[model samples]
Target chain A: MQDAPPSLLAVDGLTYAYGARLAVDHIAFDVRRGEVFGLLGPNGAGKTTAIACLSGLQRPAGGTLTFDGAPFDPVERPADRARLGLVPQSLAVYDDLTALENLVFFAEMLGVEDPREAAVAGLALAGLQERSRERVRTFSGGMKRRLNLAAGLVHRPELTLLDEPTVGVDPQSRHHIFEALETLKAKGHSMLYTSHSMDEVERLCDRVAIMDTGRLLDTGTPAELAERAGLPGADLEATFLELTGHRLRDEA
Target chain B: MKPRGLLSAAMCIARKDLREFSRDGVGLLLAFLLPLVLVAVFGFIMGRVGGGGAPMPRVDLALLDLDRTEQSAALVTALLASDTLDVVRPGPDSAPWDEADVRERISSGEDPYGMVIPQGYAEGADLILLRDPGRDLEEQLVLMSLVGALFDAGGEDFAWEMSKRGLEASGLPPELTGRIEAVVNGFRFAVEAMFDEAQANGSFDEDAAFGGGDGADDDGADGDGENAGNAGDAAGGNAVGMAEILQLTLPLELVDVAPEGRDAQLGYQVTHAVSGMTVMMLLFSLVGFGRSLLIERDKGTLVRLLSAPVPKSSILLGKLLATFFTGLLLVFVLFGFAHVVFDIDMVSRFDTLLVLTLVNCLACTAFAAAIAGWARTEKQADGVSVLLILTMSALGGSWMPSMMMPEAAQAVGRFTLTYWSLRGYQGTFWYGQHWTDPEMLQSMGVVLAIAVVLLALASRLFRTRYVRT
Candidate 1:
């Protein structure tokens, strides 16, 4: 019998807590190569926590994460991180440095041998080649968001994790970021994309997982979840509301 | 870990930090321009204070001439010609021969010496000199002695003129007058010789000659005269043995005399202060840079870096190196300003000063890192850093000379980097002591040791506790 193809990233029975309160509770997920997986949730849902845990930022209280069949220890195993990249919600790129410098710095951090070439390629892919030498401080919020996404891809990691990468950006930059993500998908790069925008989930995600209160509420293609929730021919937003209920989850 | 790879990562972090800092205009200004401004201001103030140059003492005098004779006026004019005494005319109601008023003025401690030429003073009466004992004793004594010598010579001239007139009246020849003067001097010499032998042999208990002190112990009797001679010798040693020249000019020298000992040259003092303040302010740069760690961590940049292949240790080391280099750069800028503007000598004992500055920079970086480790926000780090820097400046004698402070305070100041740095700098330019001098070497050792301990503590704290999970 031949061994099964390795999952690009796997998180099993993951659980994490903030103080006495549980933030990520036993959430299970896996991303295969060439798959664009969407983690859909409203604000304060366990989306960021799950991503943090999967990216090895937080140690799961009770779970195991493996990348390409290798056990992941975020603190000790720096080699595991070479295969992963994170584009945080906030623009983590240095504002005082130029766009190219920012990309090169991140590339260097990820152990890229030819950071300049990697930076140029990443900038070209993000359509920021012309603005590569401009300081990020001068860039618009949307432009900065696009540059942040490009910075994450400079080292060309196999698994990229984007946590709310498109929030608060202009529609133009948001479009650019989505187009870039789709292009990456076409190029067969796997990604774990988390966002609250159901339309984005519907458009970009090959498979969508709905999470609320640290638990996976549902997991399937948008159409399948919509059908399972009995919302015939409805968009993901209506189907999500039907499955998770209408009450606000503002109170902890 | 591969050495080359680690070096590459460290270099990358350093390059990134340098780029960011270079582009940060406000940071550059704070790190460099502010210290230059402070040095300029301090230098101006120090120059105005006439620091370590000399003391300028002023004196006033009042002279009373009762005898309106030409001779008496000439004698008064001679006293007025001296620069040490600023001669002033007496008030209208003042009697020219009023001994009471002269004594009052001298006793008031304003005029150091007062001279009263009594009635018939030029006609061979003794002049009375009043001196203020409370004034500088050397000035008072010198002025009194000068007046005594001048008047005694005047008396001798007056006596010769009177004898010439008497001889003319008696129809005696000049040859006969000279023979009679020789006979009188011989008789006087014989009496003085007898007195001198008696005084030397302690056979005479003449209280008047010895000022009431017994001459029984000749050695003890000679001690006061020896001390006076020694003081005269010291004063004479500074210049050729021209006592008259010293008396005429020493008063002027006293007006702006530098404090004895401590090598308090104005240039050295100003440079020392500027260097100290530079070190102090550069510590803030470290705090400022270290606050970036807190800000980045809070903003999730630290998390992002950690999420990459960068180890946490590398991240911390990168920050430490950045802070250290920034501090050193700040020192270079300050030293440059000191060299150009204040004319601070840099090359003499350069190794020692360099070692001192580097150690201080390390300590400052470590201190900043420790503060960053404990602080959770930029505001807290800034507030605490300013407070610490100010306290250190105060304790380190940056504000004032530690020697001028109370002994206990000075002792406490020894523990501060500013004190040791100032001492090390003074050792270089002021005392001209070499870096290998035991005292300077010891101070350097203490400062470097402190830097090591602080760095270790800061590194441990940063590594073990500062990172939030």
Candidate 2:
């Protein structure tokens, strides 16, 4: 009825290459406000490169990225990247810092004058309020994953990019991660989550894009992707294999 | 949250990095402990330098006995008998080196002091000291030994030359005067030889002898009480009565003051050691800081910061500032350690020392930043940094004095940052040069300029490889 909240981001004709090997070729996508967009691909896919271009960490060979109907040029200034947040697949937080301290530091980095309150909120969001004083080095893998997520949210950017946030965690930890994302969604933050796990994607993502090598194959809702693979009633795994192929990707 | 400025971001980053560094227990231990242990080891090896002066300290002299006359042999024997020096001569099978070669050897610190007796040295007893200009104490000893020998030879020449002329005009028979003159010259030689013997026994009270005092005795305390004065008086009184016919001798114009006053610098070995050790430690610190850049990228923190509301340059500046402060802290700690443990005079020229330290830290940080920018991985950065520090230390006068090094090696050393640092330090502390000296200022400026240029280059070369799959 409200025109389904305007698109918070727009991307078109994005291209990136490693040497002469093209990794992301003329890909395009959009993320609506307060909606979770899933980016899925197998290993060696262009998912990471695409995310890099979107986050302003790498320059695209060609294309444009717009945020909130405004041109967002990462090459211009750091403020261009201020509206975006990226949680890398690897743990990026300092291991020596305590949970609250980590939150405080990240919050301050984003220009928060008093980070204590935000840090506290982040601790709560990550379900680590009780372990606020503990160093991340001593944290469990799940705890670190949660803290990592907490750090990205400290700046409270309009768009958050989550890259394999729960890849190596236990099921219980995975549940915690899902809950955290759901909470962010409830707070009206758009997310771009990358995952290989079909169930997690099915449960959280409103729409998904599947890519391989350097090109996006298709993008749609869970049922739409299933049908796009020509298996109208099949699950995401069948659809993913149908689109991305069953052959294994090369390993270095 | 409000958007942040670049400076604010840099501060936050610096604080965070410093905090992280502080928590690395082994790193902190090595940072603090390594310098202290190194300083202790060097100090112990150098041992305590001599304090106060010892009268007529035993010196090592390289002597070339070119003169083969009996008189020349007698002079050498007198010198050996007068134990002020352990006279070093060429081995029997060794070839004779020229006076120029001896001078070159002494200047290179291959030999401390040397003298050459010319072919006709028996004629007038004129000797040339083959030495660099900066040999005050040594020069005086050489002069004293020469004076003792020359007085004997000159006294004989004076008596014979005068007896052949004046005694004949006094109407004495020439034969009779020659015999008397021979007796008088022999007695005079005996008298001078007695003084030489007293010197050899270390019982010569040289101060009491001349009252020109302490020219012969570097310190007055070691000589036998009144013995040198008594001997000089007795010998002079005896020689005066018989050697009335002897001709007057030339003035003993000895150059006892070092032309450059550089002898004092040789005593500041500890200061030189501290400067060198500090340079090496600062270099290690630079390596650590350089590796931190790669580590940050590997950990994704650098990429994450790029997304923050601050310029990309701010990220580099932030890390550099952090490293600069860290390096500054390490430098202070090391100097403090040296001061407390080894009694190195770090605070004597506190202001200049502080400025040099900051400049060195800045240079080292910039150097490390460039290495980080150029390297593709942490291991590459580590290896390159270590190799650089080792090579620079070895070639840049850190392990030894540049003065002792060969001319060509010294020339090459001028290109290393460590050379500039040591030069500045030695100039300031050892040579007692002021900070306003052109050479010192130039050294500082060059190091600072290096920092600026390298930092700019590093910033240009640096690009995050954040999109790795």
By TM-score, who's the top model here?
2
Q: Which parts of model 1 are misplaced by more than 4 Å?
A: A1-6, A230-233, B1-5, B47-268, B464-466
Candidate closest to the true structure, highest lDDT: 2
Error of 1 at B321 (Å): 1.6
Model 2 pairs in collision: none
Q: Per-model C-alpha lDDT, please?
A: 0.72, 0.75
DockQ for all models, in order? Answer: 0.37, 0.43
Please provide, for model 2 over B1-469, each residue's C-alpha lDDT reduced to its tens digit, 9 standing for 90 to 100: 5777778888888888888888889988887788778866764444332211112345677777788788777767766655356687767798777777777778888767887888997766557777666667576656655555554555446445545667778888878987877887788789889989999999888654422222222232222221111212222212221112121233332212221333322335666777787787787876786677788888877768776777667778888999899788887887788667666556766787788888889988988888888888988888888898888887887777777789988888888989988777777666656677788899998888888898887877675433232
Q: What is the C-alpha lDDT profile of model 1 across B1-469, one tens digit per residue?
A: 1112455666677778778888988867767788778877765565433333322222566678788798788777766654345666665796453778777877776577777877898677867766676666446434643453354346445445556557757977888877876776677678779979998999987653411332122232232222111222222111112343344435522121222232333444565567566766777667888776787777667777778776666777778788889888887777777767666666655676677677777777888888888776788888888887887777787766676689888888888866776677666655656678898888678777777887787777776654444
TM-score of chain B of 2: 0.60
